[model samples]
Target: MARGLSQPKRIVILGGGYVGLYAALGLQRKLKGNEASVTVIDPQPHMTYQPFLPEAAAGAIEPRHVVVPLRKTLKRCHVLTARVTKISHADKCVEIEAPDGHTEQVGFDILVVALGSVARLMPIPGLAEQGIAFKTIGEAIFLRNHVMSKLDAAASTVDQELRRKLLTFTFVGGGFAGIEALAELEDMARFATRYYENIEPSDLRWVLVEAAGRILPEVRESLGVYTVLQLEKRGIEVYLSTLAKSFENGHVILSDGTEFDSDTIVWTAGVKANPVLATSDLPLDERGRLKATPTLQVEGLPDVWTAGDNAAVPDLSRIEEDPSALCAPNAQHAVRQANQMAKNIVSVLRDKQPRDYFHKNVGSVASLGLHKGVADVYNVKAKGFIAWGMHRGYHVARVPTFNRKFRVVADWLLSGLLRREVISMGQINNPRAEFDRVSRS
Candidate 1:
């Protein structure tokens, strides 16, 4: 909390992602001097708009523009570049561990638990040491570089078996993340094949494995069926109701008794709320998400609110008819919930009545590539090129700051008029390459 503020309530926001940044920005705009002091605690100093991740992976946009600087944008809020190792809701304080390995306890009048989800993982044999996840910017860039490097390896290799494995890409999970990534990377690889004299489009193989009966379960089944067909039409294999039982020794084994050898494995299986939720004594739901009320507040806790993928906010809109339709963890709900959470905080401070959190599902849009997409917008379904355009348009408008919005738009415009660059700066993967060369003396 900042100094020279007497009796001013301190609002502590956890997580600097979409939810945290938006809520803090709204609170700063809604509250005045001495009204309340906002402090945002997060491990990263910036917030990433994840919707643009596929484009970044496809090399359509610059990676740096995808993240918004929390300190620069949320100037009014105190930005602590530290991880919230533990939270003490009962005592109205949180314990944050700094980058240099120091711990400190910070008190708060209002606690906002928005420590969003992390890539849900299991103790699958060899997965921990081999699989790569698509969650952070660093991971996105790594995957991009890794994919291009594999293409280079395949083109230069003389062994047929080695070339097949190097060019083969396997993605586990059929959700939005997996499908979009497969689509974008497939598009990129197909485009990149033109530059490789020895590598053709048919040389690369793309496979998607899903444990569920369908992909994009958030959309209607009809659309899911269409998505499978569309992917199949483009030579992408989709395996339904199957899980990667194990990837031990580079052998991909599915529950359906299928096995394949591939050099690249991308895991987008699912996400669970941050394990930090367990570090605190907060009330959690069956799936380990914080149990939050319709108003986005903790069920029995005062001045403590939760949102994003980490909080299980009840879907009263659908709870009566369908017991299983809780708010699907997506960006749409996060944005609306953050706005309402900010207003609720301001309302509590001013002794005003807090409003209930109610939002109609506005539908979803996903891009397969530059000209391929699937969307069900407000009950109107669209596919192919039009849907792809809508997907990019929706995300460009929703990507936070205008600076990022413009850059993303420019990238799209340039890509349409020019050839996609398939160059890989592999040196990014090894920062010490130059130092090592200099030290060889």
Candidate 2:
């Protein structure tokens, strides 16, 4: 029922993630009262702020507070709750499939390929069947419930082997997700053991396996060493320079010939660009990420732009003279890039000059658990409770939307008044509740 020019400039944004949300909102603000139409297509209607995921898992914050609904945030844009199946850049059309199995093609004047990264799974046998990833809200909630369920199972069981296996938690990878998740969950489990009749915190075995020699590589080497020592102090086993060959049939085989039985194996090794990139004819880097300049424009595609984990934007700040020195795939870079991309899009629309992206590293922070963390802010190393407080303060300010921020703050306050609930709701994992139903006769 709306009429405009015969054809208006259509800005199509894929994925409602960190980069996509920021870019869409920024565009909506910049293009106010313009004829340009911005349509954002993502499988989910919300954008998740992943920095708070560890706290959510540790029951320090509610899961819903960590995600911002895109429709509410981007009211001026058309929000499509659908998964992008394919893109024909040559034809300037995209194929989208909705939740109801309906498919449609949408035309675009300018395309923003922000289809973000997915769990970078390997060809290791049995990983698909036994491992869990930490990318989605569902995964975070399910992991929290699953971890608590393991604790309950361990405490209630009399079988020593089963108890040991239930208490044995293995996290594969050394990145922020892996390290933070391991630290938070281990702390939660340790705190929960006080309620168990027969279980002790010492009975639990927390193992971190990283293929690389160190963890939290984004931080300085000294900080990484400090992280290892802090985790070790809490009885966590750090297996560096190791790889998980397979987790087939509940038996975990490591490259170092070490084997373990664990009921929980969380794989946070790394993330690769979404496979959706292959469907498009756009230029991609060796890692399959869209080739993009610091200006956030895709190569050979004037009207198309890409950023976030899917785009390999050049690091203008890094004057190493190496072509391989691209921007790091992180929230910090994604946010700054999205803002710059939005500005460039508007500049081009208004026939103005756009600017490039160049920002110095602000440093990193990792929360180990309640009152325990590590941070390197402005080259100043901080650890213990002070770092933990800074971690909470930093993320609380970064969480998008007032609703989410208030909810997260409320969760933190309520947590102080109430004991951490360790119960598990495992039934939601399967939708078909009666799938196993059978006749007794």
Candidate 3:
């Protein structure tokens, strides 16, 4: 509670992704001193700028610069690093599990459900144990080190079979994340091979598997086709309409009856709403997303709102074309929705009615690798270096605070002056091992 504000209006924002972070920022800006107390609860202390994860993994940007610390960023808002276990909207309270494994309940006058989504995993065997994800900053860093380590292993191995498996990298997905990560890391690996005396570029195998007929459905089909061609030109095998049947014991079995042994399997298939929503009393759609109105309010639920990947917000911009159309769960929509949601919350506080959220589909841009990309803005298509420039330019402009923007830009400038770091710091995974060894000695 804010000091000197007797019984300050409590406003709680869930999750620390694009929606929650921006909403908290908006509230802090709009609310007067001690007018409303804001609390943001998330499992992590920092909010990741997900769009830059690929670049970070590829050594284009430093990993630590890709996330904003919630506590440091939201100065006026109370930031709690905890997982929301249950949301009882009816009772106007939420149950949270702290980092220390303690559960506690907190009451809120207003609630914002922005729990976001989680990686959608399948029942594929060995995936849980073997397949690495390309979602978080940690995963990106891990994959970078893991990929380089594989090359090191391949260089040292004399066995042909072992070398072949060690040099193979398989990516499962065709979306922006999957494509960008695969392309960027592949470019990195190709460049890094020049430093390794035994490893040649041709020795590395990069494969992309997408169950869909085409990749990058967010962009125009023609652009997507062009992307596929560009990828294939670089010796990347694009498997369209192919499913990864099993990844058991480093052996990849595809629905196309293709079988291969790989040491690295990257999964970026899709994402589903956070499973915690299942325990909430709020109304949810069949797909587990919260039912939200165009105004970003939960239907028939006062003082409660939802947005981002976890809410099925009606797409007013597409209602004429498709009456049942819902907003695409992307950062573009999430940012805009958070701004509008904050405005609406302020309106309700002042006894004013809220307005609906409507934004036209601007465009989409994707970076294939350094100096390579494809973009479509307002039906205008751009490919190659121009698109890559646009991709970096657009993201830098939207990547949160000016402090972070400066650091990310500085990283890009520094990368131009220095060589890409390819050394695998795999030892970071087991920091205590050295201490244990020294203690025993």
User: Mind sharing the TM-score for model 2?
Assistant: 0.96
Q: Per-residue alpha-carbon lDDT of model 3 for 1-441, expressed as tens digits?
A: 433546678999999999999999999999988568999999999999999999999999999899999999999999999999999988889999999999999889899999999999999877997899887899999999999999999999899999999999999999999999999999999999999999989999999999999999999999999999999999999999998899999999999999999999999999999999998888999999999998899989968989999999999999999999999999999999999999999999879999999998899999999999999999999999999999999999999999899999999998878867878988777779999999999
> In order, how many clashes per candidate?
0, 0, 0
Measured with C-alpha atoms, the lDDT of residue 203 in candidate 1 is: 81
Residue 274's C-alpha lDDT in candidate 2?
95
Predictions ranked by TM-score, top down?
Answer: 3, 1, 2
TM-score of 1: 0.96
Model 1 lDDT per residue over 177-227, tens place? 989988998999999999999988988899999989999988899999999
Candidate closest to the true structure, highest TM-score: 3
Q: Per-residue CA lDDT of candidate 2, range 1-441, in tens?
A: 444566568999998998899999899887856558999999999999998888888888888888899999999999999999999988889999999999999989899989999999999988999998998888988999899889888878799999889989999999999999999999888998888878899999999999999999988999899999999999999999999998997689999999989889999999999998887888998999999977899987879998999999988777577756788999888988998999999998878877888877788899988889999989999999999998889888877777888898899889878956676777777645656554322
Better of 2 and 3 by lDDT: 3
Which residue pairs show backbone clashes in model 3?
A: none
